[model samples]
Target: MLAALVPLPVILPLLGAGIALMLPGRRRLQTAVTVITLVVVLIISLALLFGVDALGTQVVAVGGWDLPYGIALVADRLSALMLVVSSIVTLLVLINAVGQEMADTANETPVSVFNPTYLILCAGVANAFLAGDLFNLYVGFEMLLGASYVLLTLGSTAERIRAGVTYVVISLVSSLIFLMAIGFILAATGTVNIAQLSSRLAELPPDIQLILHVALLIGFGIKAAVFPLSFWLPDSYPTAPAPVTAVFAGLLTKVGIYAIIRTETVIFSESDLRIPLLVVAGLTLLVGILGAIAQTEIKRLLSFTLVSHIGYMLFGVAMGTVEGLTAAIFYTAHHIVVQTALFLAIGLVEQRAGVTSMRRLGGIAVLAPGLSLLFFIPALNLAGIPPFSGFIGKVALFQSGFETGDWLIYVLIGAGALTSLLTLYVIGKAWNLAFWRDPDDVEEPTAELVEEFEERREALAAGKAWKAKPSVPRTMSLSAGAMVGVSVFVTVFAGPLWDVSSRAGENLRSPQTYVNEVIGHGDGS
Candidate 1:
């Protein structure tokens, strides 16, 4: 029964997608199926978390095949916790998307493409989280990538098409690099199973090991949007539909981070990559938030902030200690919730104000206090204000860093502090411009923005523009509020969640715990 539960999270979503695809014209059926699928997934995810806590890791080898020979699915505390959080976010995003579809002409046809594509995307995320081998993980990445290309280019606007093209090219390059790395790993270690590789990789020569490590890092770094490899993210994410952008912002890069964590802790635990990773983390944080400060548009500013905050997770990863990794896990979960809420709230802002450029938005506080509150709470949480989960997560990382007492760690710590303050300043800047200032005080767009808007308006007048002026749906507001509520719930329940994260960290630091569960302690004990 425990084995049965392990693969259900991935399988259920795929099954739902297939069913939804078969009922293309039945929007109500599609909605029911998607909602039922995710609710079941959430329940199973929670059960898996508790099951792992009580019974240790649960592993299922598909088709009754034995260790390292079959496609394996394992649910430990980390994966289960991530599954639960991600499932919640995906479910809410689906609700938000449904609201959007009902409000937009994009889904006015008898058959809508959004439902199946979204289910596939969720399936991919589930598979990535539960996969026990590198090849399965790669397959998961491709599934999500394929779905995302569709989502990114949905409604087919000129800007979206351009952004999607750039996104696809970069993703394909990264996937190719990742696939090549897998081939190298299989050649060097003779297996792509993470458990088997963990044992075998430790025996390879230092130079061969370093080569594989570098290859994997480069592949995953681009997906994770680590500094220098992250220039494409800000451009690609901002143009997608809001719910799509919210989910992508919250989950996609974290999937990359998850892969990195598995590689560092499970496969190449002894690899000498700490200093380089630390340098990347410090640079990502400083450079990312600095870019955020320079942005006049809310979406673009948040995008830069997204890149900048990835540095914190990398910082925890670079620490390579149990406490540090625990903090990373906690922060990853917290940021997923907070970041998605912020984007959804901002989506509401754009819906109400007709633009995301701060220079053109004002009087929102007086017009829509609910929207302002939704944005305000998450903004503060993202900036690491006290009593919020963001602050709790960062505090954990800071404590872990100080315990190390290294000069370099200290420098990174200071950088983190500075980044947090700057993040607050930038978010506050957006709030002041978009909400507090009187409408008459709002500035005009630059000549370039004016020209672009003029062109879009002309196209709309000529019936050539893809986007219609959106009417803000009540469901949209509710969906965004639901997400914000989740973030707040994290703050309220930090103690228990932190304890779970600590346990996850301890388990991760010892790779053998994972290996023993998957392979079963030598010949089924």
Candidate 2:
């Protein structure tokens, strides 16, 4: 079972992709495959979590070759927890996308686009978590980026195309950096195998190892959108379709953070670089939120906030302690749910009010009371108010950072809290402009070319024909409701998830165990 488990995450989806390709074009089949795949992934992740909890971390060498001779797949608490969280995010958001099409209800924005690519993306992510070699992790990342390049531009609207191109270009550059970094690692250690590198790494002198670690950091840093490298994120993410935007917001970047956490713990644990990471984390948090504060558009604002929160996870990673890492892990899980909900809710609002531009939308409360409430809860949750999972995550992260009694961390925590407060204010600004203000005063849109807009939207909505809309489709409302419901679950289930997250943190801090399982007990032991 353990040997088989190593391949399940990757194998299942590739098989599903084949099935989806052969099935048909209805998209219903695609939805079925995606939902089932996500469910299976969730179960596998949970199984891995509990299995680790009970027996211990496990690894399987591909082709049954010995360590340093073949690829490996590893499952530990941290990876398993992330797998489950990401699976849920992807599944729910994909459903949200399909639900918006309204083929069953009224003619919506005229399309439906949930299918095999999303499944392939999920498969890629699962493979990333399970990969026990550096090159394999790189392969997983490339697979996902390739799938996402299409997803990001699913609608092919000019704005989305422009944003998608920026996204692809930036990601390609980062991928190249990652590849070069891998080459460096391979050169230094003569193995692309992660477990072997771990043991071989300790044998190398400290100064030489630091060089390799720096290269990896730059590579993952680009993906993590660390500080200066982060500008691409806000630029590219806001323009994707709703479901694509939501998944990108919630799941995609987290993959980067996940890689960061993995490499920092698994590959660079011996380096005295936590302080540098801590500084970078603090800057990312402050800068990201501050950027949000300046944005007038709802999607752009959310993008900024998203950048800022990445800091919390980095803080946890930098702490290098079990408690700190656990807090970060917990926060990561919590954020994924909340972020997806927020983005989906915003998408719903955009569809209902007929605009994503905050300047153009107003007084949704009059027309969409339920929608307003849906939006409010997630916004507040993302702002980290009490009784919400976001709050719990922030508290855990802050507490962990403060425990170190490092003034820098103290400052970072204080700033983080302030950013949370202001995140509330900025989102409130959007809420105020979009929902609370008078609706009647909304100037009729001057979209003389909106018919063309509908035509393209219809095509991207899955090649369905749709007439110009006098009214918004109800399916958008239903999709929003489903997404909001998931957010509520996160707010409610903060306890059990946190427990699992803490265990993940503990497991990650003990990387020796991960290696032992993957490569088997080594001579060093």
Candidate 3:
């Protein structure tokens, strides 16, 4: 029965989501259930973080079925750490949603129903983390994505709907590509189970294996928003409700990165994918961040940043070494936390400013000093400034790149440095406009307050004077608090967390320990 705990991370959220709907619609009751369930899931994730074998993997067979036929849940270091990070980000985002009566950005929808939907999303993410087979991974992706469809379009405004349709369509196509890739894999190898396929993959001819690898790469690359397949991301992400946007920033693309890592390191052990990933990674970083440099909207800038950083993780996977993979894993974990916090902080800015464009916004420091600081810290961390988690992650990644001793890798490192600087410059440009600039820098003809006052005065002339409300968002305070808290946690505990990430990377590259443990090798207790 204890062994059955392998499935709990996935099942817990699914179970809790059902129970949440069963509860009465009282806000307090719903919040309690969501908080408690998420907390429990977080605890399980942390337990796995500590208890899972650093060098081994664990698997649980459902319904007592044998390996090939039964559904299995596997947890190695990488999945456990991902589960922990995902659970933490989900809880923090959920808390931010509940604390502020989180409203839809485009419209005024309430936050009550968001609880159940968010839990479903968490469950789907957990399933993806724990799934032991290719088909099950697809099921997890679909489950999580169906939840995402709701999250992305929660408010039902016209722009949101338009953006949501693009998001949904792009997502579905990626899934279809993934399914097609899996079909090819199953056709060639005759099994969809990862453990089963692990043995069988080596039996296939090298050329056929490379084709399957390329197929998987293309499909997952689209999901990761890798270069040439990344255009849909910036368009859709900016319009989502704030918390939904935050979670998407944190979790969604990383799932694609996780799949890419798993396929390159585990299912397809050949070094064949390295040079291709090297090329993809370099291009992804250059193209995505360059797109960011061209953006004026704060949210849009972060969206491009998300696409850009995926390249760092890809860099790790492409090196195909323990140092490289571990560094990549570390970078992935750090970026997930940092990215989620950054988006959430930006959500606060949008909430208060009532607009996302830096051109139309200013004087946040005057009105929201706390929030300005919150935004500033994460923005700096994201640009890889020192003493923050992002710098540490980037250093680890850069080390791996240099160790490869490839000139292209060095050039990629130099390019990564340039991208970091550009990222800082773009974010700095936003900061200057929104916080540092004089009011005279307004893009429009008049300051917002002045314009609003004039409109009110004109209305008064027509006897229609209603006092104008300030643009500050109600959830603004909570969003800042959540993101700031995450940044602090990452900052304060960098050492232990880095160690955990290192062990996770080690587990991923040489999966024999994981496979042997999952199959209950001769060391059976």
Say which candidate scores most in lDDT.
1
Q: Which regions in candidate 3 have their CA more than 4 angstroms from the true location?
A: 53-56, 103-113, 445-479, 521-525
Sort by TM-score, best first: what order? 1, 3, 2
Q: What is the per-residue lDDT of model 3 for residues 1-525, given as tens digits with 9 covering 90 to 100?
A: 335567888888888778777764566677778889999999988777677744356677766777756676888788988998899889888877764465332243344457677888999898888888888898888988998888788778899899999989998898998999899988887778776666678888888888887888888888888998999999998898777788898889999999888888778764366777888898888898999989888889899999998988898888888888887887888888888887877777676666778777776665567778888888888888998878888888888888878998898898788888888888889889877775555674235535554665678798984553545444545655766676778778988877877777777777666555555522221
Q: Please, what are the lDDT tens digits per residue for candidate 2 over residues 99-194? A: 665222222222233366777888888888888888989999998888888777765678888988888889888889889889888887888777
The superposed Cα distance between candidate 1 and the true structure at residue 50, in angstroms, equals 1.2
Global lDDT for candidate 3?
Answer: 0.79
TM-score of each: 0.93, 0.89, 0.91
lDDT of 1 by residue, 479-501 (tens): 99999999999999999999999
Score each candidate by Cα lDDT: 0.88, 0.77, 0.79
Give the candidates in order of lDDT, highest first: 1, 3, 2
Per the 3 Å backbone cut-off, how many clashing residue pairs does candidate 1 have? 0
